[model samples]
Target chain A: MAPSIVVRDVLDREAVRRSVDTALADFLAAKARTATSQPQLGYLSGLLQDFMAGGKRIRPLLCATGWYAVGGGEDPRSVFQVAACLEMFHAFALIHDDVMDNSDTRRGRPTVHRTLAEHSAGRRGEEELERFAHSAAVLLGDLALTWSDELLHEAGLTPVQLGAVLPLLNEMRTELMVGQFLDLDATGGLTDDIEATLNVNRYKTAKYTIERPLHIGAAIAGAGAEAMAAFTAFALPLGEAFQLRDDLLGIYGDPGTTGKSRLDDLRAGKNTTLTALALRGADAAQTARLRSSLGNPLLDERGAADVREIFEATGARATVERMIDERHRQALAALEDSPFPFAPDALAALEEIAHLATVRNS
Target chain B: MAPSIVVRDVLDREAVRRSVDTALADFLAAKARTATSQPQLGYLSGLLQDFMAGGKRIRPLLCATGWYAVGGGEDPRSVFQVAACLEMFHAFALIHDDVMDNSDTRRGRPTVHRTLAEHSAGRRGEEELERFAHSAAVLLGDLALTWSDELLHEAGLTPVQLGAVLPLLNEMRTELMVGQFLDLDATGGLTDDIEATLNVNRYKTAKYTIERPLHIGAAIAGAGAEAMAAFTAFALPLGEAFQLRDDLLGIYGDPGTTGKSRLDDLRAGKNTTLTALALRGADAAQTARLRSSLGNPLLDERGAADVREIFEATGARATVERMIDERHRQALAALEDSPFPFAPDALAALEEIAHLATVRNS
Candidate 1:
């Protein structure tokens, strides 16, 4: 195995971390300038910035770290380019996801549509306020997606490496699209069975959030299939745990910590496993009330409280927690069978991170 | 110049033309193979076919033609790939446009969101039918867009070409988004002067419909600035003519030929140059009545006729027609100024086609 893993304290990875941030910031700065040269460019760029401003730097760091992991000898700048690509795609998903969920806020601010709608409403024009914002946001999502591809292709990756990774990115997007659809479907009527929902969760969240980043980084590093397979196996289950844990947080966590509305799923009527299980096991009366409350935005403090009561009464939260725990265990088990003889330290460190992510305090 | 340009009919333009029937069939075949692989893939894929299946293939053909126009060597397959990219982008626009317009029908079929909503109403026990369709269609649009970037990057474009063109594609989408904002601005209040309206028309319609296609083709052909400038000069006015003709047809042409309701703009209270002109010149009563009838889907035949009468009395229709003619002439004049020297026969033929585009048989 190549000697590229940069294992130390997460804090100590600052040099690599700074490189990742610089790469993305430079790209965004340049891209944003160009994007705003035309009229109303300010609005779109502002939305883009707000949608993508800061994160745990998890995906990009994984990209850079994975590149380093596989013994890539190149400048880490290129890895940051790849990382930027990953984040741009993530931004694309978030923008569209917000619209799909009729979500009002993101990252602790009003969402693009919500903001636009509010502004338009203040001006007393629905045409300017709602549809324009939604449509433009949709277009901006596409623009970000195109930029992700642009950054990847121009990231100074070798032709061979670029070629190898292009199809994966393509498949990644397709899979994410499918996963989002499955998620929406599962919400509506539970047309997909439990297996289907899990698969969707795995593909949409697990793979995109973790596996694809690692695979792409490994590609840049020229890692072999054995490494990729092991990495994917490890990442997928970990990713599932990540999302399932998020589902838990969405319900029970404090809003200030997660920076999302507590129990938003109840308001959105998202048919999460927690919700689905609650619906399945509830008595007819409970089920009817739950159905009516699925998207009752007017669900006031009492409404949110009453809904939480039903969730606890149904024991769905426990079911979700159990699922999360199982996935976490599976992810760690995959790492145990990992084939790499290199970087036991990094592997061990990753296992620790997975645990923290799944059993997140927030 | 390359030898392929004059090889055959407009349909025979190796860069641009294909049998519409054949391409649609191919799109369907490719689309079918996609959705069945995952849970929600089928749902989104079907929505794409709904929006994409019926266009005149003009944009795709232009994409192909643009590839050929710059003296590139003949390769039908490559042009098809390029053309496919344009159609995919257009499909993306249509899906979102449907939502923006609150449009119920497109190309003699139900629009994406409306169809989803209608399907929900049909399904007896389904909850949130409108939400289901909107979410489904948004995901579908994302997939088509995602597919477009994937297809283009893998289109065997060189690094330099990809660098130049992919960002162009991104910029174009961004500009279009900005244009959409301007469109909302103009339509919401109609306070913009006629000049502003014309500029809005140029950005929103001409650039999207014509100039971008020409640029896309030139970029593929590796056209230098001299070539690009010439191409843009040729396309801009031609594109304006195309859109102005559309505005005219929206009100005056046969519904059978246009495949939309006659004077549909009048019924919808569209804020085009025609309407802007009418509104500017109209008295209090006419303006008030015009506002009421716009976008009212339930407007009866009599109501539509009243609006049309107001349109004629205002002389906006004739004013709009004259503007269309002026743009057509400018387009031809620009062709004469093009730096490339093709055969007089070719020039004459193209000139004739431009005339055919603007002149009505009736």
Candidate 2:
């Protein structure tokens, strides 16, 4: 059987996000019912529900658009289920990331571990409470990962669809984990390796955030080799651009708008592409300043301002902005050259998402 | 086609164990080759290989026995692959369990987190290295869980077999996580609730180690309701007995034979059935001594002896042994009334396992 051509229609991003949210809500509610026998499970499910309520649903949007790009039509239920699965997987990733980074807040609220620790204040000694909170968060993350698989299994895919999708999903999970390891290894050790930093970004963000979700959705619709290639062509550049914009925002975005502290990346000494570039370009005095200022747990606003000045003086900020613009343009060109004849709806959505990702303050 | 009768031959327990180990080795070796691009993954794989070399292979044994109990034969390759998947999942569980318990050692070797900390000692400050090790071990556990799923996917099962097995796998994972949460919540608080402690043992050990693996293997062979009921009737009681033996060993077993410190459980204030029973039977002075001694991180050899005296005086030790014998008897009776007529080989192997699990000093 020949693959069907993609259909053209104006993409409704808001509508897609709403449908994905409803799928997540309905799925979690069902989980709540199943967890009635284990009362403690209710607390975890509630925390996960609260954590998920604040997501922008970018991956789900990409997934829905991907299905549309491959001529998928008729019932939208399966696609929505798979899209919600991605969101749940993201929650797992973020919760673990917060614990690893020892961050106190996420999305402008206390992080999962912090909230748990506070709740147990009267029950445990200070040191023991902190340990309990950390372990509980880790377990919760494990549950999210496990439940994400449940969502996929219950999505009602045919055997052929599952066979096509499982390998890609496995590969995506491994790549993300490996990327995290690289990121963890690089932390607290300042490096001037631009290529290495970019490599981490490619694995952690480019392939994971963009390519895999699109590929998974297209696979669900039985898209062929040419369509898959087109997705990679569009996804890699846009995903890299997305991370680059994130790096910029980490140092520059307003906390109220971004729902994250601007000082976090600096304080944690995250080895991002911008930092690598700046370190490579800095003079001896500037290098010493970066070395001393970064990774200081007690870094204050004055120290942060000095670090920002050095970053600007080294031209890192401008260079990153240029990188984002270049990748965004390349992504748009890839979309234009898609082999699927009726991919205009996907193209429109991709263009809008590209703008939102690269130009946003958050 | 009629369901084939289970064939009778005294099972080669050692041969099944060897095949499962080979499958695990080959799968992890392939993963090592695939992970060459990310050098850091090789270290994790190496650590995991070392960690796995010392395991008792209990769950894999049960999985294979379950298959044989339901007429599986003549091509052991797929069964071995699935059995290895169970072992890998157990590794994930143990690695995370160690991290949560803040354990310093396991199987007479440094725990994963402790080893990771020592490895990073040269690169980070003492406190910083400890935190890094904890986070890294958590990530490694996540990797182990993800790779276990990959093993299941690549096991080359037919679609029908996969459909039968996936739900059992999901349920097993969820049950284990809930069990962990319950255990975590009850730690460090003295409780006289024997039922609650037993509940933790049932979910954490019985369902996870015995029932689910059997159910998964039985499902692979398309066992009917009667066969499933027989397996559960036997599994639950035997599983509880296995854990009860473990609780006794934790306090009474020799360190040289067990390859674990006897005082670890008492010092951690574990709410085992034995401890709960002792607390219930203790007099006022005995209760005060129990509270002061248990969970004392610095509790030395003398303090441990005192705790042991209290356990004996309160009759907790003898009671736990009685519980084990009762459950063992029930499991054997259930086996005697097997619904599958040709399950003699499985029954023989299971009986031997029960003896080893209950009577061994280690």
Q: Which candidate has the highest DockQ of all?
A: 2
Worst 10 residues of 1 chain B by lDDT: B1-10
Task: Please list the residue runs of candidate 1 whose C-alpha ends up more than 4 Å from where it truly belongs after superposition.
Answer: A1-21, A35-37, A126-128, A190-193, A280-296, A303-314, B1-28, B34-39, B124-127, B160-164, B283-285, B295-298, B344-349, B360-362
Q: iRMSD per model?
A: 2.4, 0.9
Model 2 clashing residue pairs (backbone)? none
Error of 2 at B185 (Å): 0.6
lDDT of 1 by residue, B1-362 (tens): 13343423333533344443345446545656765566355556666766776676666655555555666555445555666777777787778766666666667677777777776675534546766777777777777777767557646777776766776677666666667677765554544167666666777777777777667866777777776777677677776777767777776767666666664465444667777787887889988888888656578778878877887998887887787788788878877888876346545645654675567521
Q: Find the candidate with the highest lDDT and give its number.
A: 2
Please give, as one word, the docking class of candidate 2: medium
Write candidate 2's Cα lDDT for B335-361 as tens digits.
888766645667788788778767778
lDDT (CA) for every model shown? 0.69, 0.85
Q: Is the docking of candidate 1 incorrect, acceptable, medium or high quality?
A: medium
- The parts of candidate 2 lying over 4 Å away from their true place are A1-10, A338-342, B1-10, B339-342
